[model samples]
Target: MKLENRRIWITGAASGIGEAMARQLSGVASLLIISDLNAERLLALKPELEKGITTVDALPFDLSNRTEVEKAADKVLATYGGVDLLINNGGISQRGLFYETTEEVDRRIMEINFFSYVVLTKKMLPPMLAQGFGHIAATSSMTGKFGFPLRSSYAASKHAVQGYFETVGLELYDRGIRVTVASPGRIRTNISVNALSGEGTRYGQMDPGQAGGMPAEKCAARYLRAIRRDQWEVYIGYNEILMIWFKRYLPWLFRKLALRVGKV
Candidate 1:
């Protein structure tokens, strides 16, 4: 399916891959609904994206807030009758060891990263089923397919995302409900800077690997191409993507390599 004139809803559109996607799809999209917890950022981004698009708007709400997510779902369903393409990209990263992190932090990460996507999918899927076609895309991580030292909770959340979507993709393939899970190894984003520490405080610094990873716009381009092909799964990033191969074929060596890599 061509992206031109498609109704696309993107979460975490204020920055990173989401922002790059909005930029790429601005003119091609018929209705672009961007959402983020920061309303001001969303409002500010609207004009920058609406010049060529038929319609562009922002719906700001904290994904971690259940009531807010439900209300946002209602508004989305009511507006477009159902989201033609749903992009689940809103999430936080972890930077602390599992032993040091609190349960509250784990819950917060899961709420935003995993359950919110499920909630929105449940809400938006009915309309897709009614219409006989819809797509759901998620920005998972390479960690979703492999294990690492830090980011236990974040990795767990992403793993859950993969499991859920993989099941959905298999079950709904015949129903015209397509699923694409993007596994990005590393990108030049502020995810590391905003990553949660052991006490749930911000890490507040960018990691060198992230600084040197693939650019966000390039990653976004790759992802859009995958979407065009309706790919079930695709990996984005530079050398980090190779880690998936090592994990699959060289589990013992991958474990050793994981221990050797720089933390954060």
Candidate 2:
């Protein structure tokens, strides 16, 4: 819908695509409750965005922290009266062989990428349903559509979101809860550096594919348009968009092509 006067809550708002989205949407959104684990970086956005918007606030909390996330929901409700839209965009990634990956690595990925979204969504549903109107959009990944090398756990989490949200969207359709799952391909973000390594530390490096991916600002614009239109799903990328169709109608071909892409 029109973001003008819309009260939107976006997670992972400290950096990357989330940060870009907050900056671009500040002009249109009435109350932007920007949230992330890094309060300093969230404040860094103020200089870039504060000139045009009066209703910007930085909410620092770890989504992986269940109690903190729930408290954030309560804080949002108390502040804006209600959240018109909940953007479950906070998440992390993983890389390396599944066997080589530690249990903690996998758990952390699921905790941040999957469990956090579910918990936050559950908390927001009551308020949204009470209002009889709300939009929930998530930043899933192209990995959600297909499996890739060195991303078994990360892919699983994203796939879970696609399945859960798609079913919930239909189940809650009559309730006026719109759920849109955004699947973006390699975007120019610090995801690789921020991704969990097999040893549970930050991956600390950027992959060639991600380093040469789409700009975060442009990706944010594309995603925001999809949210405006209330699309069920939106895939962002140059050639990566084709992967969705490949996975849909030609699974074998997609797999064969993926083998050549060198890790996706």
Candidate 3:
């Protein structure tokens, strides 16, 4: 779908891919609603984005908190009536072994990465369905397609996202609603550094792979392109995306390589 004069709401807009998307859509989208947990950062970004033709609104709330997410969604719907595009991009990552990770950590990750998206989408669905036209784009990870070490919960959450959106996409295809699930391999973001550990604390370290991954802006561009073309699934990354093919066509080789590369 075309972005021009479209009303768009993007979560996780304080940084990384969401921020890049907000910047890129500034002049194109008629109304831009940027949501994030960081109120200061969202407020700071609002002015920069509003300099263009877009009317920018910053919505700050904790995605992990169901009540907060609901309140935020209600506010958005009440204020804008509805949006043409909803990007569920706010999510936390995991960086602990399954055996070592607490159940709380897993639940927390699911709350942010999976449940939050569901809540927001459900809240926004009524209006979109009433209008019979809207696009929903979500940021799933490469792990959504296949498993990897040190990302058990993260992968599970993303897999859930992938399944949910695919089903939704199929159901909404003929109803004038579109869903785009973006499985970005790795973009240069603070996901790793902010990932939860076994005990639920921050991992606080950047993985070498993430540091050298594709730029967030590039990933955002690819994601938007996929949405425009009404593509169901789009993978954005460097050579790491090749792993998805290996897992699909050569499971044994994929397993071997996964074991070897997962050690790092």
Query: Which candidate has the top score in lDDT?
Result: 3
Estimate the TM-score for candidate 3: 0.98
lDDT of each: 0.91, 0.87, 0.95
Model 3, residue 223: distance off in Å is: 0.6
RMSD of 2: 1.5
Candidate 3: tens digits of C-alpha lDDT, residues 1-264: 999999999999999999999999999999999999999999999999996679999999999999999999999989999899999999899899999999999999999999999999989999999998999998899999999999999999999999999999999989999999999998999999999998999999989999999999999999999999999999999999999999999999999999999984
Each prediction's number of clashing residue pairs: 0, 0, 0
What TM value does model 2 have?
0.95
Give TM-scores for every candidate, taking all chains together and pairing residue i with residue i.
0.98, 0.95, 0.98
lDDT value, candidate 3, whole model = 0.95
RMSD of each: 1.1, 1.5, 0.8
Regions of candidate 3 where Cα sits further than 4 Å from its true position: none
- Candidate order by TM-score, highest to lowest? 3, 1, 2
Question: Which residue pairs clash within candidate 2?
Answer: none
In candidate 3 the C-alpha lDDT for residue 251 amounts to 92
User: Which 10-residue window in model 2 sums to the lowest lDDT?
Assistant: 45-54
* Residue lDDT tens for model 2, 1-264: 678888888999889899989988877887788899999998888666665544888889997788888898888777767788889998888877899999888888888998888888887888889989899998899999998888989999999999999987999999998989999999999999998877887888998888999999999999999998989999998787788899999999898888988553
